[model samples]
Target: MFDADWPHRLHSAEQVRALDAQIIAAGTPGFALMQRAAAACWRALRKQFGEVGALTVLAGSGNNAGDGYLIALLAQQAGWQVQLYWLSEPAGLRGDAQLAVQAAQAAGVAMQAFDQQAEANGVLVDALLGTGLSGEVRAPYRAAIEWLNQQTNPCLAVDIPSGLCADSGAVLGAAVQADITVTFIGLKLGLFTGAGPEYVGTLVFADLQAGETAQTAPSVAQVLTSDTVPRLPPRSAACHKGQLGHVLIVGGDLGMGGAVLLAAEAALRLGAGMVSVATRAEHVAPLLARLPEVMVKAMRSAADLQPLLARASVVVLGPGLGQSAWGISLASAVAASDVAQVWDADALNLLAAGTLRAPQAPWLITPHPGEAARLLAISSAAVQAGRPQALARLCGRYPATVLLKGVGSLLAEQGSAVSCCVHGHPAMAGPGLGDVLSGAVAALWAQGLSALEALQLAVWLHARAGEQLGAQGRGLAASDLIAVMRRLLEEHAPCRT
Candidate 1:
């Protein structure tokens, strides 16, 4: 569960530095803030590791190293054995970092030059790199990071894991795989997206008493939490099925009937007033058998889809929509319709293939990395390398709200800050999940939410439901999320009031 008090706003590295500067300019000494950050990290360390007596601190030239030196001093002062390894020369540190080194020297903390031969004594504290890194990590630091990852000793990262890009979450070579990462000031957008989640084990945040300063600073993104996302409006006592809006799920080629069924069921369960399925003639029976609430129609061609498209307030396109002629014709028809839409699977593929133009209607696109890569004409690796940038580009290119699905799912609209959902579980990785998410998005939009709002809420609900169900372990089927999503939606927003 997401804590209401956790900061919702996420910043780029430059933005956080600016906020730090703002706090410094507002009367708080830079060294004082550094000390506060060290104190907070030390407290978290003790709380998590329970007074682990020996400490190994890796220090570099930046202020990140300053935090490490201060933490070493704190550990030494507590009578614990502390070994400080300098990857960057300590004599060259300036400003607050220099002060931290001086204080550590006065405290008599043992310091040595970092080398491959140096054994990790106990808990490893990584402060080798901060958010200032823009290019690939260099020699000794990279070696040190590789060494740290090879160690069995528990590790704690100050601010962020070394080598993880603060702006993009791309590993600039190799990054520290820490047991706990204590981040300070502002939450970096990188921490929750791209490759950040794998390296960041348990994330801990401290404002260094600069929340007020941060609140006034500009942020690049916002985290989607139960508290931060919008809720569905209450339904009137006399609300009728016709008033709530209809959702039409279009897809399900011959062997892929289950995909459309999952999507249609998700729409109905998510509170769509009416649900309909336009699929292959062969799928109508199984779909009706599974979910009779959906008005299933056999779509033979674009002409067969017209009547269903006319009645739908929102259309969920491509759940198992293969690249066959039948699928393309229907996709073209949906693209021409003015109904709000949620595009996934084959619909996105068709768009990427240039078979369908970007829709003019209010729309949301849910694409995994492969689909996103296709849409951008880039490698999937590139899409994952800079998910935020890719998502921004996707939003800019298409008029629709874009939802890039992966570890830390991101949703973006043209003028709004990118929203990230960090609640999903690894066990939820399976087929049909995207189909369910598309249905959820359409269902929410049908209920009066805008495309962006629907995408945000749907992403949150889907991820949280996956988290709750995924705790039971692996083999999490896609349909497993539907009931949980329904329950969660009701818990978040009741129909009655």
Candidate 2:
């Protein structure tokens, strides 16, 4: 049995197709697959609303429509009033889909052609489109999607809500805002990243008994969870400070000293063996008073950072890193260093300005939507619309593992795969979370995890911390993640061999 405890993460359209092929190859006929899907939808409907309600299944021409017809037929048998609005002529459906229509008719399913006058006031089962769609959603379907969104009642979408790109979760033009989405076969990557989370309410996945075969399909993307989170080696009573790795945070030019300081303290709290801050000479005194454990260096130039950089196991560059000459000088020096690094905030801006080239060693770049847009030279909307694709593109471009933060944060690296973190809370909307995440990632990298491993783990841990803090309600501060960070590192850290 699969680990039922794990969150059913999102999958990409390609993953779904692979699952479809696997099911077909496993001796289940294509039409039989359609019937199985329909049954799954019916079971989901009953599980959500029992037998005493009315349902309106909005269907179209593909197998997605077949699933809708089957759901309506089941509801009709259970003595619930059911209605199906076919966006295409029922006679136009071919093969398995047509079979589903005939089955629904024999069972007295009330089916009608789509009309602008149709009432959208009841529980909606959206099977208008599945993961097959690409490009923009046109005309009457767009109008139908809009009408569905305006509905006051809850909507349980079949597979995916219509108009959502199953590969990236971006709305083609408009999409049904579902309260719950029951998806079969493989999970769609689009359902968790970008606009996926907002459009696909509470998601449920049914693999249709495909088991190991279900997992065999190469996923187009992945979602980060406890499974992908890197486990730090467990701390022992015998373990010494030297056993953990040192993390050096570089940035905090002039007025922006607090950013690097925050990152340094965060690294220390996150279990770094030692934390150091290499920043402007003026910020040293205040930084020392705030975190005495942190090593504070008053640096005059990149030459001043050389000795400090040499001793560090991981370098976190960018928090409050300005675009000034001083920032450029330090960033250039960092680019030449062989230390593993986590680049965020201002360092990213510097890279975008073409002042710095790709570094000599492994690095992780954590960019929010706008920063990602700047780095990729694309519109922020485009980045947000196809986050998985954007993340993959970035990974190929920089050859660095990247964490594209926003909504469902995505992590990707060239030659590996893309993963999404679904654990964040809205209370994490405040500033400084990114800094904390960079520190955590740097600390993990210092402790010997691969760049990709560090990025995925940091993203998951940050989200888990937010979830912990958000339990109290919204408006959680970045500092609140520290306590949970300490406890969680202790709890989930892996045992050293």
Clashing pairs in 1: none
Candidate 1, 119-166: lDDT as tens digits: 788799999998888989999899999999999999999999999999
Model 2 Cα RMSD, Å?
2.3
Alpha-carbon TM-score of each model against the true structure: 0.98, 0.94
lDDT of 2: 0.82
Query: Candidate 1 at residue 144, lDDT?
Result: 94
RMSD vs true structure, all candidates? 1.0, 2.3
- After superposition, the stretches of candidate 2 with alpha carbons farther than 4 Å from their true spots are 1-10, 50-52, 235-238, 494-497
- What range of 10 consecutive residues in model 2 has the weakest lDDT sum? 1-10
Best by TM-score: 1
Q: State the C-alpha lDDT per candidate.
A: 0.91, 0.82
